[model samples]
Every structure is written in C-alpha cells, then in structure tokens.
Target chain A: MTSTTVTSDVPALVFVDDLAEGFGAPARPFHGASPFHRADPASTPIDVLDLGITRGDGVFETAGVNHGHPQAIDAHLARMARSAALLDLPAPRIEVWRRAVQEAIEAWGSDGHGAAKLIYTRGIEGTGVPTGWVYVWAEEPEGPIERRDGITVVLLDRGYRSDVAKTSPWLLQGAKTLSYALNQATLREAQRRGADDAVYTSTDGFLLEGPHASLILRFGDEFITPGTDQGILKGTTQGDAFDWLEGQGYGVGARQVRVEEFAAADAAWLVSSVRCAVPITRVDDREMAIDRQVTDGLNAFLLERDC
Target chain B: MTSTTVTSDVPALVFVDDLAEGFGAPARPFHGASPFHRADPASTPIDVLDLGITRGDGVFETAGVNHGHPQAIDAHLARMARSAALLDLPAPRIEVWRRAVQEAIEAWGSDGHGAAKLIYTRGIEGTGVPTGWVYVWAEEPEGPIERRDGITVVLLDRGYRSDVAKTSPWLLQGAKTLSYALNQATLREAQRRGADDAVYTSTDGFLLEGPHASLILRFGDEFITPGTDQGILKGTTQGDAFDWLEGQGYGVGARQVRVEEFAAADAAWLVSSVRCAVPITRVDDREMAIDRQVTDGLNAFLLERDC
Candidate 1:
C-alpha cells in the first residue's frame, strides 16, 4: 500500500487498508466467531472498522519511540494480553504485533519524529474474538511543555461503567475498546465547563484517570499513581516509569487516591504513551505548580532508558 | 407481505413483511435518520425490518385489545413518538402504521387475543433516510406465565447508562437501538445464578427496572412504581395500569424505589408490553409469597377493561 499526506484543515484520515497493509504480518490462527476468541481464524479477514472501535468495544496501547523503536514493548504487549483476557477476547500473537510495529515505524522512515500506537480490538462483527486487524499509526510528536507550568484538568462525575473492577471488567477499563462514545461525550462536557482535560470520578467520588490517559502525582521525590484496584487501567507507561523511579532510589508507589487528594496534590501530570508526561496546571478550578524534582527525574529517566 | 406462523417446539415465530400490515393503523411518522428525530423531513420515507422482535430495537406498545382492537391508541402513539424523539429517529406515518395494524389483525381472523403490540422501528435497509427504518409488528395473546408460582429475580449491580433521564435516552435508552448484547448478558448471568429474570439496580443502589420490562409493586393495596425521574422509560403498560387503578379508587403512585424497598416489598411483578404482570417469587436470595392483591388487582383491572 502507498502512503500519501493530505494537507487539509481537517485531521488526516488514514485509510484502514493502508494501515493494515503496512502493519499486517503472518500470525498464529484460531477459530471462533466470537470477538473474544484468542485464536485467529480463516474466516473473513478483519479490519479496523470490524473491531468495535467504531462502536468503542476495544482498548489500545501506545508507547514512546526510541530510535524509531517502541520502548518497553513487552510491557505493552503484556498489558494488552491482560486486557484481552479480562474482556474474554482472544489475544493477538505478540510476534505478529511486534512485526507490525516494526513495519509501521519503517513506513514512517528514520525520522524518529512521531509516536507509535498499537491498537488491538475485537474484530468487526460481534463474534467475540480478536480479528487480525492490528496495525500502528504514526502521529506528530507532542511538543515539549514547561514542566513548571502544569496542565489543567476537569473533574466529571460521570461514572464509567467499568468503575467497579479497576481493570477486570473488559467492558470498559480493560482494553482500549471502541466504546469511546461516552468518553468523548465526557470530554465534550468537560470542555464546555472550561477545562483542558477531564478526570472521571465515580458517583462515590473516587478519582479515576483522565480520558485516554493515566494520572501521576509527585510527592516529595516519590512518584505515585492510583492503584489498578482503584478502577483504573494498569498504565504501561506509568508502570515502567514507577519501576525506573524506584530503581533510581526514588520513592514510587501505587495507592488509592481520593478525589480530594488528587485535587490537592503537590504536583500532578497526565501520562500516556503519546504525551509521555504532561503536567497538570489546574484541576477543575484548583491550580498547582509543576515540581522541578519530579519533572527532571522523569525526563532523566526517559532519556536514560532511550524512551 | 405474507403472514406465516411457525410453531416451534420452543416458541412460535410469526413473520410479517410489513409491520404496518399488522398493527391495524399506521402510527405517526417523524423525521431524520433515527426514530428519535423531532422534525419530519420531506426526503425521508417510512421503512420496516423483519427482525423486529428478534433484535428489540423497535418501540412497542402492549395494550389490552377489545374485540381485537387496542385501547388508548393515541397514548401508545404518543409514547412511540417520544421514543422516536429520544433516539433522534423518525416516527412512522400515522396513516401507514394504522393501516398496517388493521390489515394484520383482519388477516389473523377471530383470535380473541387481549394483548396487542405496536412495534415501530428502523425498518429494513435501503429505505429513504438511510437510517429511517420503521415498522410495526402486532402480537395477540402475550406470553403465558404460572402466576400461581412467583418468578425468581436476580439483582444485578450493573448500572444502567441512562438513569437520570425520564424518557429513555433514545441513542442509549429509547428508540430501541439494536444494542441488546448487554441485555442478553444480564439475562444469562441471572440464569446462571438460577433466577428467572434480572432486575438492574443503579450504581447508587436505586431499583431501576428489569431488562426489557418495567417494575410494579402492591404495597398495602397501593400500586407503586418508580417515577420516571429514577431514569426509566415511561412505561406505557405501567402508565395505563396506574391510570386505570387510580380511576378505580386504588391508591396508585410513581415514586423512587430503593433496592431495599424493592427487596422488602410484600409482592412485586414486572410489567411490559408483552408480559402484563409476572409475579416475583425470589429476589437475589430472599423469597416472598405471591401476594394475592397483585393478581386480584391485575385480573380485575384487565377484566374491567373488557380484555
């Protein structure tokens, strides 16, 4: 497949066929009509549309690129596996996934200018198994931000359906499924209420993560995030960063973070594979300054790991 | 369209080419891509699908039939309109829906069936409006139940997505979108726990309603149901029963019902378009006797209506 760039005011629409062609590789096969089946089958080849992403039934993961290679590839794969299992979905073959990422990066050439996303989903049709429609996409890099200038966030009381199980319920929290209509709605609501990004809180007032991202706070020199048991996904980037932080003699831990505690953190940021770590300047209407120690420590950690 | 009835060992399957052909009169039509549309567009045309009852995305009204004719036809039409409005869908043309129902019943001959269903939904594909698929299917003699023995109900903590709105959120609640996968899952889970049906409670512990049905209770000769404020679709059957009961001098009211209140009720049953009132024998693990008041009141109500 050929790749072309369109210079329109609208966001680039990357065709799915081209994406699959660039990322597709031979993988282990399984047979079942359900989207949750672990094995690929000889039935109709699946595409992105077939995966409930259009309907928002699947989950996804992305990672920082180092020298045009995804960092902590195994961690992302393992997380995807866990998410798939939780949703009773068939897991994609790791080797196939690796090859797809490699090809996707190769398609982007040696620029090392963008992040890579690995999206896995229940293929088209409600058969309940993973279709072999996995692919990677390259996007413009997020600009570096002043760590001292934290980002602002909004707290929305719109409880997520998967808020009870942290990550066990495959319906929402586990995989980056396509059931994102509500997430988008929440974001729109947050925007309407004047906020940069929204942190979803359950009806009981427990702070979840930001939409399409994870939350991290720096207390003293320690890096802290809400535990996965607190109804949030076990973020791959957060996990890697925590391990690296602890190894460097910095305090890093996971614990339950109440909504009030998050609102009053010393320093906070939203973490994701694409944006790495973006500091939070304000939450709802409350504001905070970025922690220099935390930012420097995380940047040094990312650079040292070549992420 | 031809009408055919196939009696399987399990349940009877009735097929109709046109829903309008069955409902005696065509209901009013609305405009737009979904049945939830508020405006009527000149470009839109009414359409119907054969997979009406199977998928359950269509709006239906079950009213007592007198001499094979429905009562309070306007109320059902108005509810269907509200359902269509919520889904941003179009309603069927009133004349078309009326004619369809009339033709179907005449075809059925002298079947002294009391219950009639007016099903309106996005019909078969390729009709105008691309999304404006609408149809009606009528059924006589709703499902049979052994009311002498109460039915078992399983309590599910899984929250309903739209609980704050009085009308069904058509995109999510009303207008009968074809997303019944969760409903099926809930039923399977209930059956797995050895229950006849399931009652979905809100995340806040308020009793919502049953899957594909409404809640009714007999509390000291007063018929009580959850108010629309509790986030249930204004049930037509429940509304009719309430009006009829109040007119008959029985204290009937709609109010918010807590989960504990539902559990503690002396007698309860679920009312819907198809199932008039099925007694609840067990809730979760707690069992209750089938209160004679519910049966007596319901039978008297039905008999007084000349059903």
Candidate 2:
C-alpha cells in the first residue's frame, strides 16, 4: 500500500512541512565523510544540473532494514555496480558506499524497520564523474499489512519482448535505475482500477514481473520465477528466500512462464524485499483459487531469514 | 546533438564547481511567486527528498527562446498539461506557468538564444500538491553547428510495439515525462557507436522516433512521420512544420513506418522543438543518401518561424 514509515522508532524523514514546522525527528542527521555530500540525506545538496535529477540519468538500490540492520546489502551493492557498468558509469566506490550505509543506519537508529536507498548519478553536466549518496527512510506501517492480506492484481503489458535484454543494452532492462516514471504510473493505474497490484507481461504474452516486485509461481512443490532472459530484474529477496527454501527441501528455479501457464499455476506471488511476498488471487479482476498453504509456508520461511 | 542551451542570453546553469567558487550566474535565481522555492533557477534549493529528484515522478517541457522570445510557449504548456493529465497528475495551472516563464525570461535578458524548461513534480511526498519551476540555460555553442552539419544516426529497438500506448495506459509510452534514463542511455550508446543520434524502432521493426526527437521521412515529395498510433510523442515542432509545409504545397502526413521504408526513403530528418530539423545521414553504421536540399529547406523554414 505504501513504502514510507515502517516503525515508530525509525527516525523521521524530515518533510518540507517538518522543516517548516521545526518538528519531528532531530534536526541534525548523520553524515558520512564522503565528499559527495556532507549534510544528512534529508538536506543533501544536489546541483540542479546533476544528470541524476535532470534526466533521471542514474541508478539506485533500495534495501530493507530491520532493527537498523540492512537486508541484502551485498546483493544491492552488486546490482548497483552492475547497473553502473551497463550505463558506462564509473565503478562505484565500495568502501565509500559501505561508510554511507553505516552512517545512515546508525543515524536512523535500530528501534524499527526502515528503508535505505543508494543513488548513483553521472555527475554535473560537463564532468563525466559521478555523485553517489545513501538515504534512509522509515518504512510505512502498511508494509506488514500488505504482506498479510495478500493482494489482487491486473495484467499490463511491459511493452517489450522477453529476449530484448540479450540484444539491447540501451534499454537498461535489469538495472535498478532511478527513471521510474512508468513503474509509478503502472502502480497508480492499478490503484485507479481498484486493484492492489500489477503484473507486467512481455510483448509475447509471457509473465514478466510486477511493476515493483518479482513474480514467483508455485506448481505443486516447485518454485519458479521468470529467468533474467525475460528482461526482468533479478529479485534479491526472491533469491534469498529460495536459498532458505532449498535448505528446507523445496525445489526452486527460474524459467519463462507464458500468461496461460501463470493463470494455471497452483499459487502466485508478487515478491519483494520490503513486502516479502504478497499472494495474487486475481488476474485482471477475475478471482481464482489460491494455495494458501504454500503462501503461508514461504512467508514463514522468509520471516525466519535474518539476512 | 545536445538538448540543452537554446540561447546565448540565458543565465548560466550553476555547476557544482561554480557553487564551490561562488561565481558565474548570479547565485540568487528567481523565486516563483509560489512558496515551493524562493531562489533563482541556478541556486534553487530543492529538498533531496523531493520526489521530482528521487523518483523522476514528474513532467517537463523545453522551449527555446530567441531574442528573449520563448518559442512555442502555448504548445509547450499544452503538451505539459497533456502529459500531466496522462500521468493522472493535476492539470497544470497555465497562468502560474506563464508568470514563471515571464520571470525567467526577464531575469535572463533578451540577447541571443536560450533554453527555458518548466518542470512539474508531485510535490513533497505527502502534501498531494506540486512543485513547479522554470529553469533557463544558455544554449550550447554547438547546437547550431550540429544543425548546419546535419547528423548521423543509428537504429535501436525501443522494445515496444506501435500500439502499446493505446492498449496499455500504464506504460505512459507517448507522454514526455521526466523519466528519461532510457533516452539518455540510448544517446550514450549512440555516441559510443560513433553516431550523433539514435532512432528507436518498435519491436516489430516499425520506425518509432529518435530518442528525444521525432523522425520525419521524405519519399520524393511526400513527407510523413510515424503517427500517434505508433506510441510516439506527437512532436510539437514537427507538427508546426508540417502545417507550414502543407500550406507550401508539400505532401505532409503521419502513418506507420517500417524500418525498411525508413532505410529506403529519399531522406530523413530527426525533428524536435530545439534541434528543429537535423538530417540523418546514416542508420546503423550504414551511410544514407543526403538530399541536402530537403534538409536545408526544412531547417530554414523551421528557423525562420517562431512562437
């Protein structure tokens, strides 16, 4: 439902209203020694000319934090690096990214759930350098609720074939780039349709992914997600969950799924780091049977995961 | 080949280095009568938390100003409004935009050529309001040179079909939103391949558009551009020029264009508001025949006419 404000203890994000009113969260925020930024993320100074904002010419990673400990930090960092390389961006400084993460987590405190985001942008107009920073925000209370209640979804075409990732480097198919207008628009479209979520299909009528989450299907005991060849982002949370599930003796894998097969699957999920996984019980507003036992087992296993 | 800098008289866009040195354009930019910002375009303080920067959840219009006269002000505003409506964003207040434009143009002065951009975002996260501003940048020195020399281009797959916009409203295919990461990436890929620009073709090999500009093809005396049905942005400059061309007794129209026809056409031009009309002398590393006379005629007609 929402991505902001997960727990009461997570530090405030300092809204413009908060700043104007001089209320909520301490005025001072934690700062890393990185020259890219000195002020806390809430007040981080980014030149308007920076390609990151102006052209949305940047990459980013969002990781979930529980009790101030970030989940899947390595996966997020690795993906961000891969995205940078794809964009021909300079390699990200791992040590600096680590410091920024540590500072943000400590500054926000360990009391509750939070969301930490790392942004890397090609720097100012003429300079080919980069600007990188970390920002932490409180995860909204709705995250847990969305996880429990499950969701209904509508199908939308992602406007691409399944194999473009192999041919077109310019599309940035799997990168977690900051140019998220379409994803946001898709989610809003779902809301407007009175559906809780959306699943994107490729031009060839194959299930691709959710706008913000990965799609996972269970056929009997086998768990499958669409392969990277489908031009979908690799899901860090889904990968982690699969590892834990395999240890518990579940068959796990990735492959392409046609829209017809998706409709026939025993169970379906739109999985992500923050939401963990939400069962999708409807496709295009048509209600369907759901294997609740599978949903419960996977959700339980994911909650037990510490990293 | 750049989209920035339309005029010589526009204010200097402050670079990070400029901010550090306290030099160049007067640091105090124009504060719109709106409370969103009080600083000028060069120094406007936007909260890092602003969704405009973080998510690229916004719409923008770029208009050229020659002799302090903003070209196509009405068209740009109307297009911005259309884009906002398509995104489910509130209709932009035209009066407010007009004032912001006046303030920016006056501050920059009427000298040579400049670029004015209006950006509108869905406010500071929670307020359900908006953050809008006008920014002016001096036209780059090479814009005219590129126009005169014409440009070479390569073709890339846009990963969409021609009808995605009509069938999937969620894709936001034709709207000119601020989420331009893919467009910028495509341009970089073009530059890497020794080309001045890129033309995007649909997955089915239909001619779509140039990354930021529109594509116009000439077959003898008939001039045609891919229609709106092709999920392409309706080019303001292209439309205006076509109107003038029709009056001048030239055949002008819109329809689906396959890559084959595009390659076989007598000549082609990548048309946009800022670049006007630039000849495409190559596609996919292969040299194309240049009807320099047609290129010259279109560019001259575009340059002589202004809003």
Candidate 3:
C-alpha cells in the first residue's frame, strides 16, 4: 500500500490499476459519498468519471462491512444486477467485484470500520463494459439516537420522477449516485422548514420515500417500510435487519405506507447502510414513544452479524 | 464592417468585450441580434459559443427576426424576466440586450434570414457581476404561405422540475443552458415513436410542453397549452400569439390540454421563437386539417412587431 499526501482540504483521490483503465479513485476514506471529488485529477481516470456516472446514468450498491468483510455481498450484488437491468446498463461481473472488495479490505488493514461500496458504472464510452469502482470507507456511528426516538418528517408535494421503481432507480432514491443535486436541494428545503428530513409526496399527495434516504418503518410489531414499488431505495442494512427480525418470528413486509398511517405509527426508524438504524422521535412535530424492543432487536442483530 | 475569413465548418466563435458590447462598424444595417464570441478563440476562431449557453444555467429568448429586425422582442424579454426571477437570477437590462442584438446583426451581416436569441446566465464563477451572453442565429425564410400545418407529437411521461416557471430551470430544463443531452434523448425517442417532437407528460398524466418548445391551440380554437399551474414552462410566443389573437377578436386562453384533445384539435401548432408557429401536419400517423386563419394571423402579427 502506498500513501500520498494531498495539501488541499478536499477529499484525497487515487488511481487504482485493478479496476481497469480510466477509473478515478474515491477521496481516500469517504467511499460512495456524493461529490466524490472536488477536483478532477490529472490522470484522466476512466472508471469513476464516466458520463454514465457524471449524469447519474448508472446503479450501485453498498454492503455493511463486518469484521472488515462485506456482509451479504451476494444480496447487494443481486440488487445491483436488478438495478442495472432496469436502467439498461450492462450488469457488473459479480466475481470481479467481490475480488475487488476483498482487495480493498486487505489494503485498508484490520481495524478498518464502516461499509464497502461496490460502484458499477457503464464504464468507458464504447467498450460496453460494466466498469466497477470499489472502495472502503470508515463508517462513523454518530447518527442521532433520538432519530430512533422518532423523526418529524414533512411531506413535500413536489420533485420525484418515478414512484414505481423507488429502490431500483435509486438515482433519485439515494442510491449513492453522483446525480444527487436535487436530493441535496430537497434536504436543504426540509432543513429550512425545521424538519429532520422531507418525505416526497406525489403531486396527487401519495406518500413517497424521503430524499436521499428511505422512509421509516413503523407499524405495531409488524415493521413496514415502503416497498420497492414505492420508489424507495432498498437499503442494504435495513433489508438485512428486517430479514434477521423475520427469522426471529417478527412480521416484516413491504407495503404501500400512506402518509396518515406513517404519521400515526407507534414508533419509527430511518435505516441506511451508514446510519444503520435510527429512531424517529417525532413525525411532523408529533411525539411518539420509542419502542425499546425494535432498537434492541436491531442492535443485537448488528452485533451478532458484527456489522 | 470588417469581414473575417470563415474557415471552419462548425462556424466561427467571436467573444464580446462585455454582454453589452456591440459588433458592426456601420451598425445601422445590422440591428436586433445578440452579440457572441467563441469560448476558446485559438481553438475555434469562427465558432461562436455562448458561455452562458454552455452551462444551461441561463435563460434565453428566441424571437422572429423579420426583415433584419426582431419581432415581439418586448414580449420575449418580459417572459425571460419572469423566468430569471423564478431561478433568482438577475434579469438583463432590456435596452442593453436590445443594443447587443443590433450589434450581432451587423456582425453577421444580412443573410436573408430571421431569428434572434437572447441568453442570460448566472455568469462566470466570481466576478461579482452578472455576465450575460447573447446571440442571434438567422433561419432562412421558407416561402410565405397563407395556410398552416399541424405537427405530430409524441407524449412522453418524463417529469421535469420547473414545469411552473415560464422558463425551464437551467439544470433540468436545459433550455437556456447548453446541456441538451436529455433534450436530444427525448427528441430521439419521439422520432423512434414516429413523431416530430415530444410533449412530456407529468408522472401523474398531466400534459406539459414539448422538448425545447411549447404547445399552442391544439384543440378547437381554444388556444390552449399547459398552464404555469401545471408545471409547464411559460411559453412567451404562445402567450403573445394568444394575446394578439384575442385582441383581434379571437377567443384564446391557456388550459389543461390532454392527449386525446390534442389529437382531436381543429388545428394544432408547436410555437417557439425559432420555429414560430410551425403547423403540425400529422400526429403519431394521425392526420388533421391545417388552419389557415391561425397561420395568417400569426404571420401578420410577426410582421407588425419590432423586438
């Protein structure tokens, strides 16, 4: 492993030889974060800066790193395959991506924390290859625990392209794509309105997912999040936790969660690869009880799985 | 005016001293076309590239240039003003823009063509000044005819963000901005579906406008198009044509236009600054009768006004 010093406060970038030619490296430790690099490196790296990515014209996946190993790598890869097929981009080679992840983990050394991102772009202009950009970043567990307490979410009645392919077309559903300007804008607007995050509602008032994030699952003992049909990005960690809960005899299902029903839920939690599980203490300023069972179950699952 | 040798097939680009700068020696002959320059003079001398245009972060107006003069310039300017306000961008000085147009006309010399473009952008990174880029490209006249034709348009359910603004958002709409990838994609899709241009519908089925254009008087003589309330870019030419028609004792108003109604209109035309009242001859292989009065009225109105 080689270390290079970068003087600018911007993210450090590097070039990887294994990801084929022309792929730019991520700013050292912030894998898969938006605005990957503030400046374009001089090397003209191919894998990272392709138009497919610069235009948000591709799909991706981020898997939870457990003991420096990506968990459920197959599941994340399967989702990416589905997303790539939907977007009409070429699917990535699962084996090659897995190898790249392993190599990245080995380079990061043992004490590395956080998730590993498997970024598959449409590759170079004419090769028709599903170019991949993989990197591992340390995940900081600093999400507000009050988030698990409950969240005050406002319904924005505008700005979302498709409500059907929420998780598949993550380009809008916080799929970790480069085209996140609007999602960022939506969040800014929500912040301006004194809300934690904004849930996009259809023009006709159908409840959609949150911007650059997913909706909270809150309904009795039956935890429910908006289905893939609802246009919410299928969060990796969330999916894993739900599966684990279901194995433990809990009801987990994807359903058409309505705005009113979401507001009236007994407890709610926002899930993501990085945030893991955070409770929403309020819904549009309405307070709700934080069910200790849900949090405990999630924490135990994370611990057992060592994510 | 000093004539320069034109060599490149892509046309020469000329830079101006300022947004308000003029270009013709004896400027009387050339009046009412915005001045422009190439972004990289040494690379492409004769290629005129508008800096404000390349970003698609600007607003623009296309007006009919009749007998070397811009028609309906005030109405176009007014619409651009509204668009700029929507994006919180500064509006260009009307008089200065008008003079720049005149300078551009003189620089291009008489070409027996008519078409003026007014482009205003957020300007370069940091000059603490709103730099504007303007240019007018002449479209050779197709023989004057009294009868009008109808255009065949395809209905695309792609959602656009600034459907309410009269001018599209620079980022998504790509109207004033030179980012025309999506526009080109939509057009290609329309052509594939066997249509002349595309009319984008909202995800909820509300009819918006066309790609890089607007719809006008599709069904009956109602003179309807997607209103600002429908998230459609406010069409200046459509508005002006309707206002003029109403002044001439014709009933005209903007209303929600459906695909079925558009297909069944007595006479339908796509309106824009460059195309100006282009009659629709066929729509998705469906034929329709051309409305002569509508075309005659539009042409007369164009001849009477000075942009």
TM-score of each: 0.59, 0.86, 0.60
Note each model's CA RMSD in angstroms.
10.9, 8.1, 10.6
TM-score of chain B of each: 0.71, 0.85, 0.73
Q: Provide per-model DockQ scores.
A: 0.06, 0.31, 0.06
True contacts kept of 1: 0.01
Model with the higher TM-score, candidate 1 or 3: 3
Poorly placed runs, candidate 3 (over 4 Å): A1-81, A90-150, A158-182, A201-207, A247-249, A296-307, B1-151, B156-193, B201-206, B218-223, B236-252, B258-260, B272-278, B289-307
What's the residue-level lDDT of A13 in candidate 2? 31
Q: Where is model 2 more than 4 Å wrong at Cα?
A: A1-38, A41-44, A140-143, A285-304, B1-38, B41-44, B140-142
Q: State the lDDT of candidate 2 residue by residue for B56-78, as single tens digits.
A: 88888888777677777888888
Comparing candidate 2 with candidate 3, which one achieves the higher TM-score?
2
Tens digit of lDDT per residue, candidate 2, span A1-307? 0111111222423111011111212222322222223343333355656677777888888888776677888888888888887777777765557666766777776656677877777756665546555667777644677576678898888888888888887999888887888998999998888898899888888999998899888887788898977778889888887887688788999988889887667778888877877888788856766667666776776654556
As a whole number from 0 to 100, the lDDT of residue B103 in candidate 2 is 64
lDDT tens digits by residue: candidate 1, A1-307: 0000111121111112112222222221221221211211111122212323223334456666656677777888778777656544555567656666665566556545455555554444343334333323344443465333556788876444435664213223444443443454456556667877777776566767877678888777767887777557788778777887787788888876777787557888787776666788878777788776666777556633653
Tens digits of lDDT, candidate 1, B151-242? 79987865544364432221244433333434544665677789988887776677777766778877776888877665566776677777
Model 2 C-alpha lDDT versus the unseen true structure:
0.71
For model 3, residues A79-142, the per-residue Cα lDDT tens digits are 7766665544554555556667766665555554466665555543344443445556565444
Deviation in Å, model 1, residue B77 alpha carbon: 10
TM-score of 1: 0.59
Sorted by DockQ (best first), the order is 2, 3, 1
